[model samples]
Target: MTATQLSARALLLDMDGTLVNSDAVVERCWRRWAAAQGLDGDHVMSVVHGRQGHLSMAILLPERPVEQNLAENRAMLAAETADTEGIVPVPGAPRFMAELAGLPHALVTSADTGLARVRMAAAGLPYPELAVTAEQVGASKPDPEGFLKAAAALGVDPADCLVFEDSQAGIQAGLAAGMRVVGVGPRAAAHRPTVQVADLTSVRVTRDADGGLLVAL
Candidate 1:
């Protein structure tokens, strides 16, 4: 069978693991929370990626009062925003994103706008013009709301979108949105994305003669 390149009207991307390498900051915060809640950090980490803080809190500490989870989620968000000491762009991410500037692309992430801005700044990335953060969506990843919202914001059909995601929840969201998804990391490959790549470095996007975007890997 011949390998076919993906072509799309727009691109949607996940933030934390896909565009930015925030592993150290993420693990630190989640581990600290797990320690405080007397839960296993590894288990907690496994369920947290690509999820909103409140959602992750609810999943990890279900027995806690809803109010308590809300409060801690706020705290965790603040801590993550403040803890940008080790955050950086994922390998090939900066270059890939730089090329995407002026293109039809948006960041659709589980992180709220504030947290997204901080992390993007930490990673030295440009803020996307159309970002659909957690605050804008009725539901977070694992739900297609965010991705759908992004596609709408770009005035494109979901089928004409290409999403790059690094977490299972994110991959699932992209699939549910009816967009072609490119899994961008080791963990994402297990989710069976429509396309799988080690990282954004290998993927290339070019504008065709007809002004359409073409994605090749």
Candidate 2:
């Protein structure tokens, strides 16, 4: 659908891969973790996309108990924080965010609160007025918990919001929450979002004559 087709009251956005270029850092951290566990980094990265660290740990090292996975994930997060040199905002993300500033919007991410802060700060991204971090939601992407929580926090019905995402799992979560989805990035095209664009550069949010927010792509 075109941006004119969407009449959104709020916007829900994802962090990694969407507003931020954390993919390399994520893959490197996960690969490091996988190596320590004698697993393949490629395999781990694929399974962990848009998933919480705990979930990724569990999947990568299923033989270990949940507690251990949690600990390892924390350690990995620390490593990632120390290596934040490469982290930066996605193309056009800063401008897109500026466009949405002061508007109703929330960031929903699979990263735990601490990790989320570290990443967002590193990328010089503004913190959303509202957010659903890994600690706040029971389920991660591919599940609607985060997106739904964002909608609730924004005081908007799911149907009245639009979700911006990059991963297949994230797009699925937005759709599951009954919100329109705008996908960004290369893999975004595979998810069949309401709209697909290479980056936030292709997207624009404007006030419609009807006094509603219109999202265009």
Candidate 3:
């Protein structure tokens, strides 16, 4: 494949499915929750990715009270954080991170700070110094709030930022935030990001002359 080049002043990255392959833990926990609620596991899985737990629950069980979803989400987060089995970095993630060293970048993930920390540690990936977790945002993916916040924190214009995501919601969020998106992994391909790569191994990043990023995918 011919590599497509993208230029950006800063990069915003999603955690799960992008940097860390936490599907095993996520599926285990969410599927258990689905079974408990008498919901189909496949349906539940469809809504859980790239969004906060409480939000996913609210979507899956709309009739349930917000308080119940919030409480359950707290428990789910705790359970996921405690279970690190099968967690690993996505292919080429370590090299990807190393390439971004000294560049402007921030993690924009639906996971809370605690969950994010735990998963990143479990995957053996370096946690970005700047992160906008669920707790830092008023809305989840598809709202563009998190991505916009990360861009602001990085002191980059939204239009000058590139987002790395691996879910439909996340790709929508990046586009809504007026940034270009690099969809990562199989799940992201159907969402129509600016570019799609099987994994970080298909990507190459370097510093441009103007101190921006030159990402070739």
lDDT of 1: 0.90
Tens-digit lDDT track of model 1 for 1-217: 4545988999999999999999999999999999988899899999999999888888877777989888989999999988998898988887888889889999999998999999999999999999999889989899999999989888999999999999989999999999889998898989999988887777778898878799887
**C-alpha local distance difference test of each model:** 0.90, 0.84, 0.94
Per-residue CA lDDT of model 3 for 15-123, tens digit only, reads 9999999999999999999999999999999989999999999999899999999999999999999999999999999999988888899999999999999999999
Worst 10 residues of 1 by lDDT: 1-10
State every prediction's TM-score relative to the real structure: 0.96, 0.93, 0.98
User: Model 2: runs farther than 4 Å from truth?
Assistant: 1-5
Tell how far residue 117 is off in model 2, in angstroms.
Answer: 2.3
Model 2 residue 48 CA deviation in Å: 1.3
lDDT of candidate model 3 versus the reference: 0.94
> How many Å off is the CA of 95 in candidate 3?
0.3
Whose TM-score is greatest here?
3
Clashing residue pairs for model 2: 3-215, 3-216
Q: What are the per-residue Cα lDDT tens digits for candidate 2 across 1-217?
A: 4344567999898999899898878877787778888898788877887888778778767788999878877887778767786898988888888889878889999887777788888888888878899889888888998988888887889999999898888999999999999888986898899888788876788778866688877
After superposition, candidate 1 runs with Cα above 4 Å error: 1-4
